[model samples]
Target: MFECFCCPVCGQALIRESQTLRCSAGHSFDIASGGYVNLWVTNRTHAGDSKGMVTARRRFLDSGAYGFLLNRLCSETAAFLRGRGEKDPLIVDAGCGEGYYTAGIAAYLRRQNIPATVAGVDISKAAVRAGAKRGEEVSLAVASLFKLPLCPASVDIVLSVFAPVCGAECARVLKPGGLLFIVSPGSRHLFGLKEILYDDPYENPPNTYYLPGFRQMRQFSEKREILVRGGQMNDLFAMTPYYWKTPADASARLAHLPTLSTPLDFHVDVYERCEDDAQEPPVCEHQTHNQ
Candidate 1:
């Protein structure tokens, strides 16, 4: 699936030899027993969600509370490929945590008998391992979004779900006219959670993305109410940014929430890479505020 991956060190093509991925330059990355590869170098900093966070997220997502969001994402992706007339597509799940959407999208294509490939990448090896548990439908890897391990112009579609977006990095790995589907949290996303944490909670601020060398193609707003029990609520809360931002007292309140209702709002924006010389002056990404 990752036959197009490159060496992070020398930028040479990586060939899978046994359980190791090596380039002609001799740079090698070992594949974990869990069916995932770690291609990240520069062990200077440890960023990304912690192992505990990954576990919590997996448990919460496995509960199917976000099933609607998952299904919508995969359906929209298939429609996007069909609309572009690309029968065989190579898709990337950027910042794929626990491989939820990664496996979901891959399985959707397989069920519809579409010829395509899906790969998942994240900076966290722990997260990649958990995601690998979903099986081999996805080529899992430990990679930084800032510098993806794939070769230039190698991928057709890139999916960024509730993850940080690196426009230049995405553009670099995508074909000249490739498509990028980014899912950002809408203003109402997790407003209920915030209401429980902050003294005066506010709606999520609109995220601003600047994608040069690309133009908006399409967008969709998805809003749903998720009802979660105490355990599920705890897992969901621990996996979010609020876990780090909320104080002890506010956190105490979550333990008492036997069942909580929250809004799951996502603004999915699609951008198409323009011809190298046809890109317009850079500007803010166009997005609708899903209330």
Candidate 2:
């Protein structure tokens, strides 16, 4: 069903047979019992999220704290597809953790009567396994965002939310005029939480939205206040980069907090793949963060 997927080893098309995917070049990958495939060809032992982190993220997302963001993503993507009159489009959720947005976008497009194929890829087996258990009508793969396992010029849209951005890899997979949506944190994101965690809380710096072989189309930014309740606070904290670097004292401060009222700021940048192969020189460093 995932015609867009190619062999990571040989760069050849993959054909599914029973519980295995094999390419003509003799490279084969086994589909896990969770219904997700592992196409991560990495020599590095550790990559992506751990099981604990994935669980936290899944719980936090399922609580619907990020519902507004999800709705905006679906609306924008659906509108783009409708405007292009594309009845069937291939969408890839790069670094899709637990398939929350992937499945959501696919379902939304279906409700709008737009049949689309959605594929989710992450570098974490734990995350992809959890995603497969959801039984969404989308393909899930354990693969790197920097090195996708999709065919060249095979995807119509690529979505990245709080994930790493690999401009060269994205350009290779997208067809000319395809769209790439990058969702990053705005300057004031989580200001309240930062205030409690750091003695001198500072606003997030602006992002340099530069990508090779891509031209800026438009941007969508939103900020909203969210009340973190129950265990959601810890879950939210675990999904952010602060969890790794925050001092123990800061963490203890957060622990004593009964509830966290933080401003959630997100910026969605839409870029269109250039028709010509010409690309601008690299202008900015890529930022990597937890999803």
Candidate 2 global TM-score: 0.95
Q: Which stretches of candidate 2 lie over 4 Å from their true place?
A: 280-285
Candidate of highest lDDT? 2
Residue pair clashes in candidate 1: none
> Which regions of candidate 1 deviate over 4 angstroms?
85-88, 278-291
- Provide the overall lDDT of each model, using Cα atoms, as 2-decimal numbers: 0.82, 0.86
Report the Cα lDDT for candidate 1: 0.82
- Top candidate on TM-score is 2
Quote model 1's TM-score: 0.92
lDDT of 1 by residue, 1-291 (tens): 555578988888899888888999898888888988888897767577789988998898888877788899888778877777775678999889889999988999889777788999988878998999988578888888888898888888999887778887788888878889888888889888878788898877767679998789988888888778868888988877788777899999878777788899888888998777456554333232221
Which lDDT tens digits does candidate 2 get at residues 1-291?
A: 565689999889999898889999899998877788889887887577899999999999998888899999999888888887765788999989888899889888878888888999998889888988877788899888877999999889999988888888888899888999999888888888899889998988777755878999998897789999768888999998899999999999999889999999998899999998866654433677433
RMSD vs true structure, all candidates: 3.1, 1.7
TM-score, one value per model:
0.92, 0.95
